[model samples]
Target: MPPRPPVPRLAGDGKGEGTVLQVRRLRGGDAGAYQALRLAGLRLHPDAFGSSWEEEADRPLATTAEALEANYVAGCERDGALIGIAGLRRATSVKTRHRGVIWGIYVDPAARGLGVGERLIAAVIEQARGQVEDLLLTVSAHNATAISLYRRFGFEDYGLDHRSLKIGDGYVDELLMKLDLRPA
Candidate 1:
């Protein structure tokens, strides 16, 4: 693949008055920032994330860097602080090569409703467009905000995976959503 394009910085809420979120491709040096934001998300919204902080904490820095390099990792930074992140991983199976999975989507509580998640998702979708026929993602059924956001981007629910995650003593259902990029 060609060198990933530099993340574009756009005007956000001027300084602290609002929120100025810059969405761009993540790099090797961003492993710590990514890890921090990711762990925060997993802690705050356990059902929204597939991986736990415990699973990621012991991971090698090289592994994190490799993920940033191999996958389409986008981050939303405000005032030089990383507050949000999303990633798109291309399917490796031969039959699923035309699809990409959207994962690790998280925005800090303080950054919600400031368009940071929207920008991050938009960047990921734009990056996935040419490389895959469709983008697939799983979201907690109870996450209305994210569901609305994905719907606004033309993603539609195809099915539900009931009892997909065993959280604590109960199970949670996940909604499977897909955004088709093929010509109509």
Candidate 2:
């Protein structure tokens, strides 16, 4: 298969003071920045994700770079810094090829509420179009903000996991959501 062309950079309005938000697919070269942002999220919001900070923080750069190339990871940059990221995990198996996952979406705390998350998700969906028939994600049941954002993008809650993620001594239930990319 030929290489996938680089996704063109998308420009969007950032909140206040002439901030310009640049959203684009992150590449292997972006490992350092991506790791920083991702580790921050994992450390700051342990219950929000299935992956733990301890597990990913120590991962080698080569592995992170390899993972970046294996998946569609979108990064939102503001003033030359990676402030937000979202990833599309497309399936490899033929039976599940019609499905993809929206994963590892995180926006720096300071950049939240300025539509950074929304743009990251939009970029993921744009890349998923024509590539998958459906996109799915599991958000922590307690994360109303993230859940609402997913709903805004047309994701419907299909089920709930009673206790899916165990973080430290607590458990977090997850809401299973899906968005159909096909017309009914």
**What would the per-residue lDDT of candidate 1 be over residues 4-118, giving only the tens digit for each residue?**
3333343355455656568899998898889888888888888887787778778888888888887779998988999889999998899989999999999989877678877
Candidate 2, superposed: residue stretches over 4 Å from native: 1-18
How much does candidate 2 score in TM-score? 0.89
Superposed Cα RMSD, model 2? 5.9
The residue pairs that clash in candidate 1, if any, are 13-19
RMSD to the hidden true structure, all candidates: 5.6, 5.9
Poorly placed runs, candidate 1 (over 4 Å):
1-18
lDDT of 2: 0.87
- Per-model CA lDDT versus the true structure: 0.84, 0.87
Give the best candidate by lDDT: 2
- Give the per-residue Cα lDDT of candidate 2 at 59: 98
TM-score of each: 0.88, 0.89
Candidate 2 pairs with clashing backbones: none
